[model samples]
Target: MGRSWQGRGRGRDMEYDKGGDNIGGASLKKIETEKGVIARFVIGRSANKGDSMDKSIDAENSQTDDFIILDNVVEAPEEASKKVKLFFAYAADRWDAQFYAKANDNIYVNMDALGSTLAAHLGKPRAYIGCMKSGEVFSEPNQKWYEPEWWKFGDKKAYFRHAYGEMYVITNALARFVSINRRVGSKKMGFQERTPLMVAAMYGSFGVLTYIISTGRSDVNRVSSDEKVTAHHCAVSACFVSIVEVIKILLDASTL
Candidate 1:
């Protein structure tokens, strides 16, 4: 990989303590691939007025404000492939962009790298997309491609399971990714093909439910390919009482 880095805002360099906590105003972490591919890593706390880091950390603890930059990464040697995979796995599962405030400097500085890296990895594209959405990676929906070629129709259903985990909020990034990848209406996930609506409903993500329904891409009335579950069925069975509005949205969309 190339050694050149285009540094953005000025940041202080602080060494990691034994426990791996950043001691200064901002933390700097460097990721070096086995073949010696190194990239800049920087994380900043969110400044959104009402956003809390605690609230974002749920049972799964899947979110973080850690904005990372890999766009400067040129190319990796063959030996570093495994290291790259491991890094993506850790980043996707541990530190997503869900709870961060929009327009933060860390995110703004590395938007292109963030989007490109997330889209390249298929193992947890949803998680990657969640992070990107949290950062508002793209101002317009059509500016980027968020999915890989392997994400066939039924794959999203399997992927939807991860959304229920902590830190995976229902952001426009998720919706936009599904729309662009043409996985919005897929029924191929499991023994029963659950649409995006059912997944959102089961996960009790009202924002995702509303957004998918508004897109008019999901078949709100269609039952699962095997289980015969509709979005309403998922809502009722999943006990999504907190989002009764989702039920209403699904109901209204069905009539149109």
Candidate 2:
């Protein structure tokens, strides 16, 4: 008598034989018969499901063109491949949806895994900055509502957005990240002695502007070297309705 197999998962499907030939201690449930010999049979416990299922069951070719049963494993190529490629697909989809619609199909790397792996590959400071800029947020949940900084690779100080006159609203996640990560506050040597707070304000990243000021990383009245203009000046000059919230943050900070 062979041991009875109990499948795991909420609705896992498992096939077995009622009374097939016993091979060793396991029963041989022949999937196919060719030349009077059994074609395929299962031999081990099913693989546990995790982020990826470890293929534990073993089956042998019984003689079926439609399906290949290794030990007792019968898997459709599409189904099996999806399990293996789940994370990769998920990461790629997120990156695509958030950043570039045109290059979505071009990306093949697994961003979920890439977030961890790439961080390890980069220098300590750079790795941290890289993941943050890429919007990976390893420590925090990358939820839709938890918007991250719009910063990206090579835009270390968010200079490009300011230089090109682009504006954004920073999210709570980005605010927390910058507020907690002190190293990110280090100002870069640029044409304008614009602190991260100044850059955030200039680009109209209200959440970041508020956080930087509230965290005391920047003096609300701090001015740029070139123009001597403060965050308040920038918000007023932008004159966009979206900047209204940023203006409120700046005004409140100035009073403090």
Query: TM-score: which candidate is best?
Result: 1
| Per-model TM against the reference | 0.18, 0.16
Which digits, one per residue and each the tens of the lDDT, describe model 1 over residues 18-84?
Answer: 1233211122123111111122222222233224532332211222222232222212332122222
Model 2: runs farther than 4 Å from truth?
Answer: 1-168, 185-238, 241-256
Worst 10-residue lDDT window, candidate 1: 206-215
Candidate 2 lDDT over 126-227, as tens digits, reads 111110111232223465533244343243423321211122222223333333442332222111111111111111111111001101111122222223
**Would you list the C-alpha lDDT of every candidate in the order shown?**
0.24, 0.22
Q: Show the lowest summed lDDT stretch of 10 residues, model 2.
A: 206-215
TM-score, cand. 2:
0.16
The Cα error of candidate 2 at residue 225, in Å, is 25
Candidate that would win on lDDT:
1
